[model samples]
Target: MTTLAEGKAPVHLWVVGVLSLLWNGFGCYDYLMTELRNEAYMAQVPPQALAIFDAFPVWAIALWAIGVWLSMLGVILLLLRNRQATTAFLIAVVAVLASFFYQATTDLPQAMGGASYWIMPAVIIAVTIGQWMYANRMAAAGVLR
Candidate 1:
């Protein structure tokens, strides 16, 4: 139970969102610079990490590049999610789960290269939880109705 003025979002949510913004920006840079697919640099990554993208062939790089843009779009959509919290929450939830998957598959193996991934997802999850809980509480109090 959070105090009204205390903010429904815990510190983790804001931290994650900030991380998401940064990582997405980095992804965008990697794509625009065409550096993500650089064979020489790619070779430096652990074989397992590189293989995940390799499995997708050309699609992987494109998707990698697109992730940042999609996240930004997600944020914009999330803002409007007040009228559509479910949809927003769903997207945020998927992202949170994906972050876990990514960490399990790629991030935690060595040095957790991407701080952006860690930060963004955490924030989204925290905020979403807070918002939903707050909304429910308000609704119960008849404020929403």
Candidate 2:
């Protein structure tokens, strides 16, 4: 039986799990679309903004992939009621921090549009942190096995 069956899973567990899946799923879509250079999607990006992505160094690209993919994996682990979700979320947060540091230290911020460019990243950071905290709480409560 699912670990969730040990006791009735809190409503928030299902709610957060499904929501995390949907949220991170979109992030995966964004990552794939950009990595694949999907013409229509790429075309929608302003040339200067696109250049920032195109100019990503190998390490930065790898970190970005780690951040996105790990977060996606965290969502799956969360849904499965696995304690590993906490570790996955933590790793994803670290990857995100590294990637964000690279962007903040580079010209990408200014090129992507200035102060306004940080909105999405800020939201992502907050949600990721929230997910990590949630996972830790779930594990401690024995909701995850």
Who wins the lDDT comparison? 2
Best by TM-score: 2
TM-score of each: 0.36, 0.93
Off by over 4 Å in 2: 1-5, 109-113
**lDDT score for residue 64 of model 2:** 90
**Over all chains combined, what TM-score does candidate 2 have?**
0.93
Residue by residue across 13-88, what tens digits does model 1's lDDT show? Answer: 3554465556545655655544447766565666755555455434434444344455555444333323233344
- Whole-model lDDT, candidate 1? 0.47
Model 2 weakest 10-residue run by lDDT = 107-116
